[model samples]
Target: MSIWWSLHLRREAASVPLARRLLLGTMETAGVDPDISYDLSVALSEACANAVEHGGDTPDGTPQAYRVTAYLDGEKCHIEVTDSGPGFTAPHRAPRPASSDAEGGRGLCLISELADHVQIGNKPGRGGAVVSFDKILKWRKDAPLMAV
Candidate 1:
């Protein structure tokens, strides 16, 4: 069986917690192994943060929203983070942590290393790009995830 979860939230920092909660719930309900759940949570958080930061316009206290989608098959999980402002070129390589003792740009690197597959592309009929990743559930003996 395949399971899906989705959420749309305004482009505010406060919405991050909601996203995290939703992500955690989805992973838990989908039976993701506990050992890898932390990494998935972190990676998904990073992806959503990027979408909220770079992919959307200024907060302005207006009403713009970002979308996150997660789907799980028997042995794999896939996720997509999207914003409403605009789409840009995919990062050839994930941004590296800065040497100035700054904490930034490490999210993509972590996501890339943790997920079995990562893809960035324009969302169909949308104004922004979708940053997506997938992880294979190693603890299960189910068949492979088919691209249906």
Candidate 2:
């Protein structure tokens, strides 16, 4: 079975820092390669930011909380970013990047390009959605050994 770690927070922007730390800590604990930490951090942060922005608040204008779950399975680390707001649909894939544009709905697109795998959709049994992704760990043969 895979190992798992979870973090829950409210809809406020302040919670982002805490989320990042937890994710980094979890990855480290699971023996993820130090070299890929930056990629994981950026991808996870983007997913969590989307959750906080779109899923945490009630569609009716009330405040709500959010949750982020991360786990490691053998050679891959998985992350799920979920929220308390009503469910939403993932945006359709955009066409090739225009040569001169600077702004748009490219967050998910960028994440998909970076992460090994990406899943975005509603959380079953719960309202709202989750943006999940996984990254394959690259082991360093010369690194100090740590018992699994």
Candidate 3:
């Protein structure tokens, strides 16, 4: 089975869980393996949290909304979170924060560890940060998500 969705949400703390719930519901309904679903959802939460906290750094004031997109094609799932904040200078090499006790700065590190493939950069033309990731889906034998 193939499924896809896109969400444009306000850059607010409340919107983070909304995005996560949608992802979780879609993955569960699609019969993706529980472990995989959980991992991706956690990673997605980190990405969404980053977007919410940093999405409004545009010169003309912070962007009011961010975009989250997810696609499931057979045994693979891809997700992207885009924000209107100033793009990251270096997402290709996200090292753990120097201060372990720091309350933040670990989003990208967590995402990189969970996702099989990840791409981070500025959105085409729009000049925003885009964090995209893909993982091979592991499905439950009886979920009927695909031929599996």
Candidate 4:
């Protein structure tokens, strides 16, 4: 069986945890390994946080919202977070590791570390940042919704 979900969330700090919790709950119910779920949740948090922080404003100066989408299919899970920001200056490149003393800028690097594969780019015509990742899943032996 396959499961998927999407959320069009306001770009606010509170939305980050909301997205994380939904992903965690879905993973838990699907019997995904806790460790993997944790890793994905953390990555999702970072992505959402970036959307909240950097998702830019509309021409009218109102904050634009972002979107988070997830899919669990067969033996893999895919997640994508998209924002209305200016987009990455260098598209499709793995971000450089942030300096230890830097206050921020580690999220993309951390996401790349946690997931099996990652793609950072811009949405086709809309022209916003898109961060998508995939992970091969390991299920608990007793996973209630384990894929056959």
Q: Which candidate number has the best lDDT?
A: 4
lDDT of 2 by residue, 1-148 (tens): 4678788777777888788887776667655677676687888777777777776556677668888888766677788888866776555343245345665555676678768888877777877877888898764454333334
Candidate 1 colliding pairs: none
- Model 3 worst lDDT run, 10 consecutive residues: 89-98
Candidate 4 structure, TM-score to reference: 0.96
For the record, the alpha-carbon RMSD of candidate 2 to the native fold, in angstroms, is 3.4
What lDDT tens digits, residue by residue, belong to model 1 across residues 1-148? 7878788878778887788888776666555666666777888888888777776565575646889888877667788888876776654555455566766767777788888888866766756877899988643223233323
lDDT of 3 by residue, 12-65 (tens): 899989999999999888889999998899999999998998886446675569
List all candidate RMSDs to the true structure. 4.2, 3.4, 2.0, 1.0
In model 3, the Cα lDDT at residue 146 comes to 62
- Candidate 1 has a TM-score of 0.77
Residue pairs with clashing backbones, model 2: none
lDDT of 4 by residue, 1-148 (tens): 8899999999999999999999999999999999999999999999999999989898998889999999987698999999999897774676789998999999999999999999988888877899999999999999988988
Candidates ranked by TM-score, best first?
4, 3, 1, 2
